[model samples]
Target: MLQIKHFSLRFSLYGKGLEQRDLEVISSLDVDIKAGELVSIIGSSGSGKSLLAHAVLGILPANAHLSGELYYQGQALTKKALEKLRGREIALIPQSVTYLDPTMKVGKQVMGVRHDAADVEAVFRRYKLPASVMDKYPFELSGGMARRILVSAAVIAGAKLIIADEPTPGLSETLAKEALAHLRELADMGCGVMLITHDITLALEVSDRISIFYSGLTLETALRRDFEDGGRSLRHPYTRALWKALPQNDFSPLPGFQPYAGTVTEQCAFFPRCTMATEECLHPIPMRDLRDGKVRCIHAA
Candidate 1:
């Protein structure tokens, strides 16, 4: 339903009023979501996960410049096309509950001005939200309630593709799982779902495929099953490191830190911390197909 190829986002900042420099936030990002699949983008805080979300929804800041191709249903997705689809065919469940309007009642916001009351009530029931909660204002709702309400909004939008940014944050474990399950259900119903999250465990639970984002680059895109058995089938070293770091896995520690996004380099983004790095890694790395998935590392055989 959607494709983003060689996507990059750059911000122009002026240091001394006239001295301008470009800070590339997202580079060489490639993501594809099919009609009946849920793809999770897993990364740390500054890995440009949220930026990718904003870029897709055409909500990036005015100062930001984007390069790459975005497509929906095989046609070019331009700014005007995106505007037409923003809240209708493409919807967002933002990470912050503050995305909700404090002035509007929850039901009216979810169902829209011309939408049916029955649709709102049905979505509320799906999320286990009570009927009484519909009349409540955004400020009156609790965090968990608000998160569910966001889920309610996205599902009610009946969007062909849904971008859910960290939807499970701050929720109870049960609630988190329930929310992911709901997203999975959306994919099952033929709605492409792009789930942006930091919680790898939560992502593994519901995503059909997982894309690892690191330092504004996509390290790997592997199937959920590839994450099994210490990520043996996974191609990228970073992805394997992430899998082994999980409590249920090897539970080992990886040294070093993710480099800053502004740190310019020619080698692979993971080169500095990669144990298997050699002199060949000093060159720019290109994403290549490995096994059944894709990895950005050239050394992954």
Candidate 2:
């Protein structure tokens, strides 16, 4: 069980003083993830998806100023508190598995975290990793093997919550599915999991709920059934465009530019690219309750 209330993190662009122009990243973000529930965060590259992940894990760089209430199992978490929680209660499987130690053997690296050799070995075998590969360093393994190794490390850490950022980014389709299956197993075992990805198809396949982010702001969140049954109940315009772009036995282009950090303004971040934009779009958008979930948009009601 993890919750983020009015979470705000920002990067300073220039001189001191809190001005609208000084904000470079995420504004107010609210998120709630429950135990044994797999939630996926879908958004374009620079939409603060990864930033939210890092902020949750307290891994963001020093220059970034973070202010928010992050709670794990009802316990308030600060940067210092999160540092203690990492590698034990919260594990991060980064976007790149190549970041693992190249000099040490795979078994050594995994055991270094939890110091449980038997558990680490069991995880490796469960992931179908060969016994011979255990002695090899990160550089010696193939891409798929490296990905599995990262997954093994996260599992062996015995963390209560796992934040996986593009866990299957570079793998082939079959391998990607395999990696996701492993994450599904983790969720079934009662670990609160956040799968951060841009692939809606994969997210729909594995997640219990879906949260859509656009321009560093949360757009819509809904049950998996709502997304599959044509997403008719969806409110946000960005979500409508996303559902329209899905390949349905036909390939149609989804035209739009990816959102950037500094491009969006305080007033309706998606207004510039939104086709349904009206004069009301220029005003500050508020989060409207639609009974099923909350959506931030003028037209969501």
Candidate 3:
């Protein structure tokens, strides 16, 4: 299980001349994933979904600064803890196939430190990957095969928590579903899975809960069922708009764009585009429990 509380990430960047400024990319993100549960983080590109994954894995750049806390199975995910947990108790299925080594054979990479060929072969078989794929290079494998291999690596590690960052992009619909199914299977087998993706519709089919992220903040975290019936049960305005925007729903487009990262104000990030925005929305909004879910909008009822 994993818990992220009041998590924020910022980078110290140099501006014109010697001026140094902080660019906040993630703010007040709160999410928890329990064993046998799959939580999907839905947001647009550059919403810091992938960055959250990197932060948890302790792979962020040197200039990056973090606030708040990350806990795994009731323990703080300190740098020392991360060093021990990374790729062992916790594993990442990265966004790109580029995470695979071109020089190393697929089997060797998937085997990892355990180097258990039998375990690797069994996992490969479960994904319908041929035995011959073990001897193939990363370049030689198809995109779908490569994706399954990434999942296999996590399986081989016997990780308790799996962070899958944008794992379905660049694959066919069938392959994408296949990839998601693998993650679903993992969660069913008692693994905590965090699926970071932009496709809310696709995610809804597999996620137990959905966290609606925008402009570097999570506006709402609701159960998948709340997204039903035109999202009438959804709390946040942005969340309902996203549901309506889906082709299977109203397909109605929201009027404005998400604010750029680092441009977020202390006030509600959705204030500019929210039709329901009041003068009160000009102040900071904190996430609070509502109907067994969580929403950052004060007006939500």
Candidate 4:
């Protein structure tokens, strides 16, 4: 239900004396979510996963400049359209609970005030929230409760595309599984869910597809099946490295650091740490369709 093509994001900074420079955080990224699918974006801390969410919701900072086309339900999803759909057709489960209003009662924030009490109560029941939570303030809710509140709001919206950014961090194991099940249920009901997270292992269980992000770009998009047997079924050097780094796999850590934005040359961003890098990797590597998915590596078949 959502498609992003050649999406890029940059931020302009003004140094001393108006000396300006741009930091490119997203570059030539592409992802698609079908009406009944849940796609997970997995990457390291600075991989621009959250930036993609802000760009889609049109909540970028004033200094942020975004390029490329974003589509929703086959229509161009412009900024104005997003403003109308953000809290209704397209909802966000933000990474930080700070997005919650400290002053407003929880029910008002979740149901948006105009919603019927019965509808609000039903959504609460589905998320296992007690009726008493409606009268509580944000401060009264624990971190796990706050996360569930975020999910409950989106479920009530009946959003076609739900961008859940790190929605299960503070949740208990049971509550975390419950949240994932809810998202999966939403997808089964024909809603497109974009689950952005750092937990590839857990994401594998709920997400239909996985898109690996590295240094501001998507290195590969693969099915959950491809993540098995030590990533033998996947492509992209970075992706395999990530799988190996997982405790369930080789437990080997990748060497070298992800370079700061704008410092990347036409050469592959994974070049410095990639043991398989060749001199031919000097040029910009375009994404290629291989097997059943896409990869941004030249050596991948």
Candidate 5:
């Protein structure tokens, strides 16, 4: 129930000697999540994944300038609209557990301003959180328990769209799978879920579609099935490279690094490292439909 079109984000910062420059962080990012669908955004640490979540929640810093359009449930997500929807119809499961209030009890925090203890208790029970854990402080809960509480808070709020940002980091493999399963369950229950993470293997397990993000741009959006057979069905070269690098695959390390944000131009960002790059790749590349998926590379066929 969310649509992001031609989205771009940049920060205006003062440079040396009274000069100002704009550092573009996200450019031409296009993604859409339908009800009961889970879309995973796979990217590296600096790919602006978390920034997109913040932008959806209207929590970006004041200096940030946003372009293009964002929509929820077929309506434009203007600043005023976001103010009305944030934390009510939309919720964020942040990257850090520190978002929990250290001073507040777990139950109260989940209840939020709604103050519906029964709702909190019901959600806690669904997640298998014991009643005693509610009275405890944040530091008293284990990592998995804390994660369940965060998910519980979103459920209690009746959020229609959940943006889970890097939810599996610092957890054991089992715990990580458990967390992802919960998100999958939510999507099955008619909630739109956006999973922003770097682990492609874990994402492939539960995602209905996968968006390959790099250097703040989405290079490809492919179905989960497209990753089969060494990603031969995948549309973008960057996506295929990622698949080959997986340990279960070729495990071949790609040369060079992703271009740093703000340094990316309209040309293909992967051109520097792409083996098939030609002088034609120096021109602007727009995302296009290809074989039931979307890819940014003009050479994709």
Candidate 6:
């Protein structure tokens, strides 16, 4: 159970002999994860999906700045409180396992999570990881193997919520499927899972609720069935583009480029590339609660 209200993260870049320029990666974004729900966050490459995860976990970079109310299980998370809860209550599986220590054995690294022997072994086996993996170091494992290690570590920490950022990246199709299966299993066991990914296929397969984000804002949120049934019922140019880009029979790619940070005006962010753009698109778009879910675009009702 996590709630982010008006959450925003900003960064500043400095040039030689110049003052720093502010860049907003996520602007007034809000999202919630209920207990035991697996939510998939999908977006193009620069959509700030990872940034949102980092901000929630209190793992954002030093130069960056963040503001907003992040509540966990009805408790407000401040700077100090978040530090204590990050690894224990809120586990993060970063995009890459390449950062895993090469020096330590896998089991040793995992055992460092305040968990019991039985729990660790059970989770490892549930993911179909072998007992032999524990004795090996990071270099000895394959990409999929390392990903599993990270997953194991996250779940073993007794975390109430797990934030996985591109968990299936760099894996083959079969491995990706297996990894998603493992994530679903975690959700089934009462851990709220947030699977942040750019891959539409993986998102659809593993998510209960899918949230489409673009230009640091949530375009739409809907059930997995909404996506499977042609997704045409779901509107929003960016959402349409994403669904079309999926490998399907009637796919028609959306023309033009993805939205960039700070480049968007108060007008419709997708208007430049959206064929449906009209004079009414000049107004600021806000998230409206449709009967099915929430959508930001004015035309997507």
- Candidate 2's TM-score: 0.91
Q: Count the backbone clashes (under 3 Å) in each candidate.
A: 0, 0, 0, 0, 0, 0
C-alpha TM-score for every candidate: 0.97, 0.91, 0.98, 0.96, 0.98, 0.94
| CA lDDT scores, all candidates in order | 0.90, 0.81, 0.93, 0.88, 0.93, 0.83
* lDDT (tens digit, per residue) of candidate 5 on 1-301: 9999989999999989989989999987999999999999999998898999999999999999999989999999999999999999999988888999999999889988975878788889999999888899999999999999999988998999999999999999999999999999999999999999999999999999999899988899999999986689999999999999999999998999998778988678999999989999998789898987799998899
RMSD in angstroms, candidate 3? 0.9
- After aligning candidate 4 to the native by TM-score, how far in Å is the CA of 214 from where it should be? 0.6
Model 6, stretches more than 4 Å misplaced?
116-119
Candidate 2 local lDDT, 243-271, one digit each (tens): 77888622445576756656776668778
Which residues of candidate 5, in runs, are more than 4 Å off? Answer: none
For residue 5, give model 5's deviation from the true position in Å: 0.5
Clashing residue pairs for model 2: none
| Cα lDDT, model 1, residue 105 | 91
Candidate 3 yields a Cα-based lDDT of 0.93
Regions of candidate 1 where Cα sits further than 4 Å from its true position: none
Candidate 4, residue 280: CA error in Å? 1.6
List of clashing residue pairs for candidate 5: none
The regions of model 4 sitting more than 4 angstroms off are none
Model 6 per-residue lDDT tens digits across residues 221-273: 87888777677667566776778777673567776776675777888777788
lDDT of 3 by residue, 87-196 (tens): 99899999999999999999999988776888889989998999899999999999999999999999889899999999999999999999999999999999999999
